[model samples]
Target: MSVFMISQLLIVIAICFDLMSFQFKQKRMIVTCLSVSVLLTSIHFALLAQWTAAALMLLAAVRYIVTIFSYSKRLMFLFLAANLVLTVVTFGGLTSLFSFAGGSLQTIASFSKSDQRLRQIMMVGISFWLVNHVLAGSPMAVMMESLFIGSNLVGYYRFYGMKLSS
Candidate 1:
């Protein structure tokens, strides 16, 4: 198979990890699953030659992994700064903004104390990611982001019922 096909296949696997992440009530488990998804997604973007997305995903993977162990506002700030620098360095144009925005939100979400809050932030982040995926020409990543939003909503409802408090 071609590299593009392989990238799509990788995204499919990453999607499974992303979707499964939302189902967990614990933040650590959620971040762990998302870490795997982010790492795989980084590779997928790299294969597609989307350097901005790839670098953002790589940073996101590191952020997720770090947060899974220990996270603070300082750490979040550092990640956000790194993300901004990466986005500027990669600078793929308007499409880069979408991934940067999404990754920024997800970085904030990673530092959230509440699971519901994390999911809520992630929902918004995933929306931005959907646009980035479309612009970057990754149909599978777009589908993954869409499904991730749905899964997050369902997971939120499952855990918190109708009330949406932080």
Candidate 2:
């Protein structure tokens, strides 16, 4: 298969990981799945030669792994700072802003104590990623983010019933 096709396939696999993340009630399980998804997404972006997106994804993957162990405010700040540095280093076009915003929000969400709050924040972050995927010309990634939003909503409903408020 061509590189483009391989990248698309990788996105599909990443989508599965992301979708699985929201189904579980435990935060660790969710982060574990997200870590895999982010790592796979990083590889997908690398295959597409979207270096900025790939680098951000790598940072997000590391953040998710650390979050699984401890939701430290210090670590959150460190990751946010690292994200800024990566954005500056990658320094592509306007599209990089979306990745940075998404990554920052996700990093903050990782530190939240409540699952609902995490999901809510993640929805916003995923929306940013959706925009980035559109601007970056990755249709499958866009679809993945869209599905992730829906899945998050469903997961919320499954866990907390119909109430949207935390």
Candidate 3:
């Protein structure tokens, strides 16, 4: 395998950590694992030479780390503001619109207290990100997000039963 593909393997590890994060009942524990995954994912993006994705992942890591300490609405708004600023700064035409949408959804998700709501919003964000990754030619990111969606579906079914209610 090429060295790039080897670097992409980090995303797989990060995805595993992401799936494991939801298994925890405690919010802090879940966010902690998510923070670790995002950190690894940031490194993966950096390796792929995708500066925008790297920056977004780093910011997401910060968001998760802060979530472990507090779930304040103020913080969510801050994430919203940051995501907007970052999206503008990193704009690369229509192709990057998916990243903007995904980040926006993530910031919105941060405002919710319910795990079900969180998962739902995050799934949508992941879908946006999956499209962005495909367009950006990041195979690992596309693969990770696809698996993330599936994992989230399983978690949702297991936790919420048949109803998709939050």
For residues 1-166, could you state the per-residue lDDT of candidate 3 as single tens digits? 8758866888888888878876765667667777888788878767766666667778988997777677798888888788778767877765467877886787677556777887888898988888878887878778888887887788778788778774
- What is the descending TM-score order? 1, 2, 3
56-93, model 1: which lDDT tens digit per residue?
99999989989977769999999999999999999989
What is the lDDT for 6 in model 3? 62
Residue pairs with backbone overlap in model 2 = none
TM-scores, one per candidate: 0.98, 0.97, 0.89
Q: Report how far residue 152 has shifted in candidate 2, in Å.
A: 0.4
Error of 1 at 103 (Å): 0.5
Model 2 stretches astray by more than 4 angstroms: none
Candidate 2 vs. true structure, TM-score: 0.97
RMSD of each: 0.8, 0.8, 1.9
Cα-based lDDT for every prediction: 0.92, 0.91, 0.77
For model 3, where is the 10-residue window of minimal lDDT? 22-31
Model 2 has a clash total of 0
